[model samples]
Target: MGVSKMTGKFLKVKCGKCKNEQVIFEKPADDVKCLVCGEVLAKSMGGKARLKAKVLEVVR
Candidate 1:
């Protein structure tokens, strides 16, 4: 069996400015910003979040 679509996971990313790590929703309703540098990490496009930086991992 494969993973269900209903079970969504979070995305782990690193800030390009300060290298701070954070977890964000795969499909964020709003823009995801870095807590340290306040840089835009992801942008909501009415569906999945558009990543602005490199993704570290996916948190299941």
Candidate 2:
């Protein structure tokens, strides 16, 4: 069998409240929060995380 490319990815995001840059999963199991501030950056949507912050870059 051949290996297949995965769709899931890591993302670089900036917190809306604190403007803190953070790295998160595309599909988070739980709510992703800012490291600097206690603000929700991404909300788990059972699939792809619903981003509450600004997406800076998409990590491979």
Candidate 3:
């Protein structure tokens, strides 16, 4: 099997409501709501940047 070139690290972001920390991976998304308090925690950026894939969403 070939190794996936698209890889990134999960980041720990603070929850806006509960102020709790959470971990997330590089995926396509708008913003992750806080699981604890239902408040928007952090947005998942397309940190898995790949030159091959154009569908990859870039957060910033």
Q: Highest TM-score: give the candidate number.
A: 2
Better of 1 and 2 by TM-score: 2
Estimate the overall C-alpha local distance difference test score of candidate 1: 0.88
Report the lDDT tens digits of candidate 1 across residue range 1-60.
156865556889999999999999878889999999899999988789899978999887
Candidate 2 lDDT tens digits, 2-50: 2356568899999999888998988988999898998999999999999
How far out, in Å, is residue 40 in model 2? 0.3
TM of each candidate vs. truth: 0.84, 0.85, 0.47
lDDT of 3 by residue, 4-54 (tens): 764554455566556666654545355666578776545445543222112
Estimate candidate 3's alpha-carbon lDDT, on a 0 to 1 scale.
0.49
Candidate 3: pairs in clash: none
The residue ranges of model 1 lying beyond 4 angstroms of the native Cα positions read 1-7
Each model's backbone clash number: 0, 0, 0
| Candidate 2 deviant stretches above 4 angstroms | 1-7
Considering summed lDDT, which 10 consecutive residues are worst modelled in model 1?
A: 1-10
Q: If ranked by lDDT, best first, what sequence of candidates would result?
A: 2, 1, 3
- Superposition error at 41 for model 3 (Å): 2.0
